[model samples]
Target: MNKTFQYVSYLWDEQKAKSLGDDQVALLIYRSNILGADLRITNYGGGNTSCKTIEKDPLTGKDVEVMWVKGSGGDIGTLTKSGLAALYVDKLRALEGIYRGIAHEDEMVGLFNHCIYDLDSKAPSIDTPLHSFLPFKHIDHLHPDAAIAIAASKDGEKITAELFEGQIAWVPWQRPGFDLGLQLRNALDANPGIRGIMLGGHGLFTWGDTAYECYINSLEVIEKASAFLATNYGKKRPIFGGEKIKSLVGSQRKEQAARIAPLLRGLASSYSRMVGTFNDSDTVLQFINSHDLSKLAPMGTSCPDHFLRTKIAPLVLDIPASQDLSDLGAVKSHIEKLFADYRDGYKKYYETHKRHNSPALRDPNPVVILWPGVGMFSYAKDKQTSRVASEFYINAINVMRGAEAVSEYVSLPLQEAFDIEYWLLEEAKLQRMPKEKALSRKVALITGSAGGIGKAIADKLAEEGACVVLTDIDEDRLANARKDFGKDAAIAVKLDVLDNDTIGQAYKAACLAFGGVDIIVNCAGLAISKPLAETTEADWDLLNDVLVKGQFKVSQAGVSILRTQGLGGDIVNIVSKNALVSGPNNVGYGTAKAAQIHMSRLLAAELGPDKIRVNVVNPDAVIEGSKIWEGKWAEGRAKAYGVTVEELPAFYAKRTLLNEIISTKDIANGVLAFVGGLLGKSTGNILNVDGGVAAAFVR
Candidate 1:
């Protein structure tokens, strides 16, 4: 089939680009292709690119304009005014002498901090200092398809030398950021007038006096090398017609548009308020249906730059025409097998070629897949991500076609792709944060949270900046409680502890609503004041269900989500003071609380491997705004003490060393304390928030 290339211009509007301020222009570039699309093509933010904008900085005694680079975690497409972090050029260049001696990540992080405002943003992209060392006015580093096609081949050096004819210099792919940047600096120093640099199993870096020039050089360099490969390997026999493939992909595209339009709209609606506004119809369904998918898949990426969009691979499913395979377990299983085999092959390749830490095997999903009749699978993190992935695929197809025309295009090893995909330090950086302050992005679930102790713990956690999901069976009390805290203070859920399934569903809903859960405080418990003979089976069951079973179920669900994020979490259970110092009348409630204490310890021991910490907070005499302060709970106590209802609280408070009522806020603070750094390293340890009542009795 004679395929006609479609020109889909992604370049920004010239007027828009012109009107942008220096910071805005840099952001636009970072937001568009350079950062968003560029980082995705390799591994987790693998390839680095920076623009040398003239900016004023006070150094020595005079003010000078130096380059400020994109800080780490600064998603290019999502790049904002705060994303471009500053680094002094002289300081960056000076590191060239000692970059090799840095042994730990902290040293590199320190070096980056010396040149940047660490508090303002994430660690500057490891390439920040490297970009600072470069002499170019405008710079771009990418994993281009054409370059790697030649570089990853058996005769990579020979092929690149013949293709570029000594125009582009090549470097072996080293660990990126500091190490790789140092190597490149040395290479550039040795070879004075090099236009571009190609890292084996990595990508390409090019710079110029202007954006257009730099972009043009990138296009021209790849275009020439791709032309050379195509001249040699161009297909002579017309194995497939372009029209036939297009027709098949066209119909599938229509179906895909229908399936994804609503879904993309929903996702956009959910996230638009935060950042990265929604994609238009054209972008949302850009590559849903592609005509010549077979031809494109073999082409791989126009360069390695497509990884940011397509990922390392896509999840390929062979759907049978007779059955709806999307929901079929058998179909899903088959797809899983294909992904596993592909990953296994990648592992073997990695072991054979690379000598270093073994990369984590990512999900064996293909970044781009060829479906026989439906067309191609273009996968990405989101809508814009998909769009970027498709562009890389299109470019890769063009480069591969051109390279094939010149010669057989050699692909990179699967292991090399794995190295780029599962870079450990890169993965570590994505999850790195202060453990105590990590709850900022997390949602916390606290049960038995209405009035008294439960409400207190909920309030403290909310004040500490956690989005609290508070639940209790008291519908009226819970509603009034939420109102008291204000509408947006916390989410109030009516939870019946007796219903195990409902507790599980609540956990799931919290995750779906607010990303994932970081903490679970099981405080929804009740006390049954009765003699052992008077305590019925139903009363015993009720106590066990709320105090012991409910906490267990919710914590189970919370752990699963936490593990996916790769951050260990914490859980606090609200046990009663009676559990430690019990009376004959409180047998049922005390026994349930006893079981809860042991359960918390067991969970702590079991979950310690995953870094999930669990502990208990025992509260005494919490009767504010409750029947316990007026009715049956205070009835017998008042009579025995020969005191009034208000005096009962005072009597209990006086028995303690501090002589202060343990308010809901007191217990809540204890929960928050455990949530933070105040608890030291102890887990499974019981915290007494009872005004020293238990300590006095022990002494």
Candidate 2:
């Protein structure tokens, strides 16, 4: 498990990136991406890396253009020439003192660029002023997982002292951007050879004469801390839960793995570059795995940087009860409870420490979790995300478990977490980049997309236009849709929502095919007929899982992709009339539909400020074979309703004031209206394309 530690050698490869006219620019981006890949180092745009070069000022008769920073809204991995924004060091430093009096941060942000009056489309990183303030030519600021993991602990100061042995200075978490930059200036003045500084739970700040030195310092800091934690706690070796009983649980590890891989894929697609799954259920295997599990689970995050990628919690399993439930219901319930507990703990933590200016709480779900005898659950939003979550979990668990042997493990303080969460500087940096421009280069995933509704919506988006990844449960239909649309228009992926893992995989495929995903349409849904009491639990579960739970899982999985892309995105859920208006024989279908509607709304509200938009399309009875109208349903219900096959259209269509069947075109258009931003200031709002069905007044 030993890895080489090198600064100049690891980060200075010319072949890794495209050749640049300015070698400094090329090195800056390459180094940024390398650091970005390590969770212990960065999270979605949290850190900024820059290179300084002297260029003659046109008017000042002196050298300027001291720095080129990572552009706001660009991930380090995908950073491009357009992603590196420039700032004149002279202007930045002089302007710094000018905006000091501005109380509002946002207003102060405007001042950073005020001195240089020009139409600069790209907003400078919030740290522009700080970069201006720094004398170092190469600066790297990261929320390294190991350093912060120790820094966030109860005795962070003490533990950090022991780990680094006075190699670096430490600062309490301060609001990043201007204030922290000023504080860092003070720290730098105090400690001369301090290669790095830990900002409590926030992250780490490091600088050197070049990108090579900065990156090397980042890697060395984490490696040293990891070594300390391992030496202290690695000897514990093992931990255990309830013993598995064989009779009740026939080894379904393969089956479980098969079932979960797609779900994990879906979750992973939402965040990373790739994803992988592993499952094992042999009692012997479980025992073998227990030692590592015990060591890692109790350990806090490998480092605070891991938090941005994997979150602060992992799913733990109680072995005995897992075998009792024979069906997926039990598994779903068990997993749900773990996520719920994590969320609850997060909220309680927030309440305890949010003395004032508490920001909105992040979703409590663990990015990665362990399934005990069943192995592990790597819940990433994408492939690279999967890697990020998996690696961080392993490291965090290893470190924390090791620390427990020497001392009680403690988490980063709540206030420190808050500082990272609502650090206005990071938010401001994200705000600088344009939303449309940020998402312009990425791909998207759209489900329930054959012909009619899904097709039309997809087409509209393609025209707008985006690289669309389309999917549906219908194999033949999906094939035809692809043929007609052409491969250039969209890549058709056959997906079954019933299989959670498949849906996950579909999302991953979409992301891989197209650098990243920018939008997701949970259009895969169906209507089942049955009286309320007569609807069997099986029926209820089937429809509910497909419509409600399916959407939930997909959205949850897609979040990381959207966030990582840096540009916020849009999610459109195609709901039904049953959600808004009750109808006979719509039991299980209606219930699930209702949940989908509310879920979309809640997500819209929660993700709004992040620049993500969520909305729903509730269309009334659409025409047969016309997207929302499944022709098969008409055949089954025709006999039950005592209506001729010919009369079904009239029977359904007459319910609307327009007296016309809602076509797939109408439903799809309504969905596009929201996602395309046609309807302004209308988020979390439902648009009913029921042919004015509500105006009909069902007697």
Candidate 3:
């Protein structure tokens, strides 16, 4: 172990402990956070921890020993006391005897559930027995990549001994269950002096009398594995392809990804519905573009923990280094065959490992797909999961590289991987998650999304679980808007609605970012409220270009991508009440908006055969959070109404039957009602979001 890698202790601070109230629980959370904060120790939800403590039993008014293990679905890094489920120690320990005859995995889960001390507490982690069975006050189990690299090696046992000098016990890979728990318990009993246990093909387990001790032990073991890998394997820089490969793949990798991602996404959709995000960074590109990727990638995941996120193996698309990626038809045909082959391979893997009670076959779509010319694409139902799978697979590449540098990289046996994949406990963790949001797995693209009604719509769509693409002419504001939504929920693109090329590029970016968009919100517009006689040809052209032509171009681009994906989609245009009821002197703005409404109807009629729906929202006076009604436009409108600027908002509100001012959020809600399928089977409809503007209501 590297003795010099200092471990910072957060539990020793009295003030911090005082705030949490329970010193022991505070210490446990502190240490768990420490483990989670470091990707080298654990990534996301890859590990579990536990602490044995004495707490007063509210019913009996007596102190009782309880095992507070990490609750199901809890990530150690951000875990709190509430995230830990407490089980009565004596009752949980008694299960060891009862579990002897219980071979069925489902029965074991029932038993674990029955042992929960608090009725309201979360289900305990499956490894609860592994911790309870061990005679330790504090325990930490993690799937650290370094430890996994050593554990998944051909001579893992020998390497473990050399690195830890018999300080840790080695248990052969066992499917995590009652039997595996027993094996772990018996192994520790025989090696009573060991500080930790390394499960072959799995991960590391360490325990101590205190949180700091257990944490440090985990750190020491990981440091030892890292040091061993560094000393034995030595670092090998990935081979960036030669000029030939680079020239063939194209000098612009990002542009190549944009072009190729849609084909891959479309192909993947044939097997199952999923969204894909592209990765073409230096590290990912270096790994994917390597000559030896074909030999290295199929070996398997770095550890069994990855089986749930990333499938057992990635699907490698064989794009010839000499081929051009610009040919969409060729790329599409190749991807179709690759997806079919990958699905067939997965089915065969399942058939070979099928058991009488094995879980149902999972979606056969590949989570990780490696394209030679265009880096990697990770697919999931949502952007977050796709990104997570990408991270895991990228790390897998590094782990495999390190292991191969020293020795052959060996993953768990196929059956073991299958066991983890089908384990009832892991399945339960997924089942325990909250119901999917209304727009879960859906992708939305909003135009003019930098601020106001457009941004509101973007926020609402994302809140409903849709990955959004926000576009605007204001690049800085668009970037800031994307940042506000975070990378997981939104991506930004600078777009001029009037430019056909930019509109097409934005559609491609959406496809590259999230498979393909399911919803298109056209909110970009220009307002010029002038008398018909005063309106100039240039004024009419500008409004027509931005409000009518721009929207038409965006819709055209969006529908093309949607058609290629073969998935039904929705288009909601943010028009104005002026379209329904013409206001005096607003010739250009009203005429263009009226054209948009008519265009949407035409589009709906044409696209209904493809299951595409087109709808329009007519908002009257959205003064607050409305960029359209600001500065000169607001002043002109107020003057036209013969009212002060401050009174203009009130005047418009009082004109409505509801006598209420409309907000951007109100308009967004109306759009959501249509696009989110609340008005199912209804298309070519106009939703009036003008706070009860009766004249604007669709007749």
- Ranking of candidates on TM-score, top first: 3, 2, 1
Candidate 3: tens digits of C-alpha lDDT, residues 175-230: 66666677778988888899999988778999889876787788887877877776
Model 1 TM-score is: 0.47
Per-residue CA lDDT of candidate 1, range 626-686, in tens?
5445566576456545787778788889988888987877877788778865664778878
Model 1: runs farther than 4 Å from truth? 1-63, 76-350, 356-412, 418-445, 449-494, 510-520, 525-573, 578-616, 622-654, 660-687, 694-699
| Local accuracy of candidate 2 as per-residue lDDT tens digits, 499-618 | 777776676556434434667888887766766677789988989998998898888877755654445778889888778776667778878998998999899989988678888888
Misplaced by over 4 Å in model 2 are: 1-11, 14-22, 37-46, 58-61, 94-110, 115-121, 126-130, 149-165, 213-233, 236-254, 257-326, 329-371, 375-408, 419-699
> lDDT of each structure?
0.58, 0.62, 0.80
TM-score of every candidate: 0.47, 0.53, 0.92
* Residue 592 accuracy (lDDT) in model 3: 93
lDDT, residue 247, candidate 1:
25
Instruction: Report each candidate's C-alpha RMSD, comma-separated, in the order given.
Output: 12.1, 12.6, 3.2
Return the TM-score for candidate 2, rounded to 2 decimals. Answer: 0.53
Which candidate number maximizes TM-score? Answer: 3
**Deviation of model 1 at 94, angstroms:** 11
